[model samples]
Structure formats: structure tokens, C-alpha cells
Target: MDLTDTVAVVTGASSGIGEATAKALAREGCSVVLVARREDRLERIADEIESDRTLVIPTDVTDEDEVTAMVEETREVFGCLDILVNNAGVLRVDPVAEADMADFREQVEVNLLGAMNTTHAALPVMLESEHADIVTVSSVNARHPAKEGSAYTATKYGVNGFCRSLRKEMADEQVRVTIVMPGPVDSEMRDWENWEGRALEPTDVAESIAFAVSRPEHVEIPEITVSTTDKLR
Candidate 1:
């Protein structure tokens, strides 16, 4: 809760974990910038923020130009960005042989490239800040792949790999990187599946994300894995 007045950008903030994380950040007194493709949803969420310091910028993180402009505009409004939450993602489930190329490509574009694009743009601003953090929303599937999860698994794996490498790259800088892997969160992404068991709520993962970044400046949590205990998956 030591983040009062700090600036944070949360992608995929229109719904699910991203939306929850934005609210959690705001509750911790962070000035949040909501980034996603849905302006109506973003505006609705922004209205609920108590700080009156939220910026809703409709963005497709898969596009580098949009991400670039997003960061630039965030700097213009907030002067600097202290935290970046790379939570924009999509899910595609099927065996590799049965996979549609379009679905696979879409997954990669949003889950993998979107995080990369946002991180690419935010790193420069983060480095200049007195203290900064980058928290990526991966999945437990990134480490434990499931059946019928070829494309989705691949993107989460890429997320895991990318964040690990970036953490090392930013180790010497004030900026720190953390990869958050959660399993079966109760969100639209999981609802698409015929998943019937209990699932972690979006707020669960959001709080985990908040805890990761709330650590003292001298302590950096590199990875966090949150999953349901009784899901019996």
C-alpha cells in the first residue's frame, strides 16, 4: 500500500484480471491508466476510480504504434509511469493438428506480442523513474501445459520465457520485472471453456499481482503462481 501517487498502466483493463488489477492498484493509491480496445468498458471502470486520476486510452496492444502512443500519452498526462501490468491476453483451445491458423495467430498476437509491445514502450520511461516495476500476467499453463491447449499454451510459454529474460535485462536498473502465473481464474477467458469446477476469482489474481509490486524497493519478487486448491484439475 505504499504506492500512493504512483502511476501504473494496466492493459486488457476492460475486463477480468486486468480490470481487477486496475482497481487494486487504485485502492493502493496508484494513479491508473486503463488500456484496452473497448472505450465504453474502460470509461465505465475509470468512473469507479476514487482518485479521479485515471486515463482510459483505447488501445490494441498488438500494435506497436498504438502502444507507443499509449505510453507517450501516459507520460504527457502523468509525467511518468512507475508500473506496467502486461495483462492483455486471449485463449485458443485445440490440438495442434486441429488448430485454426487464425486462432493460433490471434492468440500469439494478443497474448505474446501485446505484452512485448507494451513492455517495449514502457521500459524507457520506467528506467528513468526513481522506482519502477513490470508485472506480466502469464498462466500456470505456461509451466504446466494442458490437453487441447496448443496455441494458448505456446503463448503463455512465450510469456514465461520473455519475462524471465527481461527480468535479467532490467536487473541492473531500478526497474524490476515479475511474471504472474495463475490457473483457472473465473473470467470470460475460462468461461468460454466448458469448465465446471471451482476457479480462482479475478480479484485473487489481482491481489497477487498487487502483492508482487508492493514489496520494498530492495526486494523484487520475480515470479508468482496462484491456483485454486480444490479445483481437482
Candidate 2:
């Protein structure tokens, strides 16, 4: 699908890969909707891009009502939606036995449920479009679990399952579903201090996302895994 003139809603657009994706899409001539709890950050990003090509919507994806309103406002402003990037996520790293229940809940709410809320709310508008795409920023942890990161990995696993199932359901609808899994990246969500190898930059993942959505209307990129060569598994 050509990104020119297309409208894309990118959740967690406040920072990291989400931020990069919003900018990348804008550069591709897309009308990008920046969604995140940080209105100020969203506004800052919006200012850097063409104002008319971006809409800043301060939203908490965990809230179903806010997510619904987000989609409604996007339609109200852009008239149609072409891409939905479910990128809002949180990571609470701890062993299962000692993990805080609240932290676990937070991860599940933001990483898993939040994606569902936006997808559910945006499906109608997307299906109405000539061609649409649902691209999710998942993690390599979804496939390879780590010892101390059970909760975070679980949420990603859930996200992976959801996207795969949704992809099958939308196979005949001209709506493409894709999952971009990245290894450790230097972002707000990760601390690279303890790492031995260089991490992939947010723009690396962003470029992958841009490539996936830019495919021909007949082709669908099911998944893309990006990681630094030194960081195995």
C-alpha cells in the first residue's frame, strides 16, 4: 500500500520507536496521528513535522474509552484511517515469584489490552478504506523467553498471538496485519548500561516498519525481526 496521503495512528508516539515511526511515516507523505499520554512530547514531535500532516492526541491506550475517542477524533479530523500502529507497551522486569502484581497488571494493560482496544475501535474505519494495515511493535522476547523477564515476555507473547490470529481473520479483507519484533534497542524502555553489545537504534526498527507498510497492495509482510548482529537470540 502506498503511504502517500494515507493516515496512520501511532500509539506510544511520545518516544522511542513510536516517535521514529511517526516521523518516518510523515516523511512518506502520510497524515500521522500521534497518540500517547505525553501531550507535550506529542506536540513537540508534531511541531517538528508539517503541522497539517500530524494530529496530536493525548491518549492512554489502556483506557478503552480514551482509545475509542482517539479513533473517533482521527476520523473527525482525517476523514479516514489507513494504518494502525499498536506500539504502546511497558516492561516490568522481575522473576515471577517476586514480581509485583500491580506491575504485571500494568504491563498486561498497556502491552496487550491496549493494542486490542485500539484495534477493535479502528477496525471499522480501516475496513472501509481501500487498503489498510495493522502493524504492531512486538518483541523478540515473544518467541524466546528470558529468565527474569517473564511478565514482560508474557505480554509480548500475548501480543504476538493476538496479531497472528487477527492476521488470519483479515486475510481476505485487503487489511494487512504485521508484527515487527526487535531485539534490545536503546530506548526509554531499555537500559543499555549493562549490555555488552551495541543495541539497535529506534530508527532501525522504524525503517523496518516503513518497509513493511510500503509493500504492494497484494503483498503482506507477516513479520520482521531486527537485532544487532552481536546480540544473538
Candidate 3:
């Protein structure tokens, strides 16, 4: 569908794929609502965009009230919500047996529960629109678990499952749901020692999201797995 004048809410928009996706959508004539904890960065990115139709909502996705407020504010500012991108995530690497349970809980809270919180808030708004889409950023680790990354893997795996079930429930509403699995993206979250060489750029993943949202109304791209050609197993 054409993104002209469509409204999109992007989580984790302070940097990385979320920031890139916000800019990409803006370039496509979509009015984007950028949600993140950093107000200064969000404003900076908003200023950088060419569109006059960007709203920066400083929000913590894990907070239900903030997420609900974000959804309400987006509707008030943009008039309609066409897309929701659940991209907020965190990673902690350690052997499952030796890792701190608190760290594991933190990862689960942000990666899994965070998405759920945002998605739950956005769903009602999306249902009221003519056509809507939900795109989630998952990791390849969801399917290919690493020895030292069990907690991270578990959260991603849970996100994948949650989106799948949500898609089935929303199918009749004409709300398209897509899950993107990217491998070793070159971001601040990656550790150089564990992940070396060229990794997928944040913009590359943003492009995937743009492509999925830009497809014809009758077309639904459910799942996309992207990895560096060199990293292919």
C-alpha cells in the first residue's frame, strides 16, 4: 500500500533500526510517531526528517500508561494509525547456567513484555483504521540459539510466537502482521569479540520494513529472514 499520509508508530526510535525506519517512512510520505526514552535524541531525529508530520513521543515501551498515552497521542496528532513497529529490545550474553537471573528477567521484560505492551496498546487503534500493519523486529537467534545467549534467545523466541498467534487472531481484521529475523546486525548491542566482520546495517533492516509496508494491499509479507550473505550457514 502507498504510505502517503499514513501514520506509523515506531518503538526504539532513538537509534539503530528504529531511527532508520522512522526516516524511511518519512521519506515515503508517512507521518511517523517516534517512541523512545530519549527525548533529546528523538527531537534531533525529528528535526532531521524532511516531513513536517513527525511526532516524537518519549516513551518507555515497558510502561503501560506511557504506551497507551503514545497511542492516544498519535491518533490525536496524526488522526489515524496505520502501522506499528515493535523494535525495542535488549541483549545480555552469558551462559544460562552462570547468568544472573535478574539480568535474564530484565531482558525478558524489555524484549518480550515490552513488545506485548506496545502491541496491546496499538491494536485497538489499528482495528479502527481501514487497513493496518504490525511489524516486529526479532533476531535470528530466535531460531538459531547460541550457547552463551539462551536468555536473549528465549525472549526472541517468545516474541516470534506471540506475533504468530496475534497474526492469526487479527487476520480477519485485515491487519497484516510481519516478523523480521535479522542476524548479527551491526549495532551498539553487538559485542565485537563475539560478532566480527561486516554485519547487517540498521538501514538494511529498515529497508526490509519499508518494503513490507509498501507492498500492495492484497499482498502480505508475513516473515522475512535477513542475514549478511557472508554469514550464511
Give the candidate order by descending lDDT: 2, 1, 3
Tens digits of lDDT, candidate 2, 82-182: 99999998887776899999999999999999999999999999999999999999998888776678888898999999999999999789799999999
Q: lDDT tens digits, residues 1-233, model 3?
A: 78998999999999999999999999998999999999999999999995689999999988899999999999998888999999998888887788999999999988999999999988998999888899999999888876698888999999999999998998788799999998888787775246655799999999999999999988999999988876634
Worst 10 residues of 2 by lDDT: 190-199
Candidate 2 yields a Cα-based lDDT of 0.91
> Per-residue CA lDDT of candidate 1, range 66-104, in tens?
999999999999999999999999887887898899999
TM-scores of all models?
Answer: 0.96, 0.97, 0.96
How does each model score on lDDT? 0.91, 0.91, 0.90
lDDT of 1 at 172: 86
Name the weakest run of 10 consecutive residues (lDDT summed) in model 1: 189-198
Q: Which is superior by lDDT, 2 or 3?
A: 2
Q: Give the TM-score of candidate 2.
A: 0.97
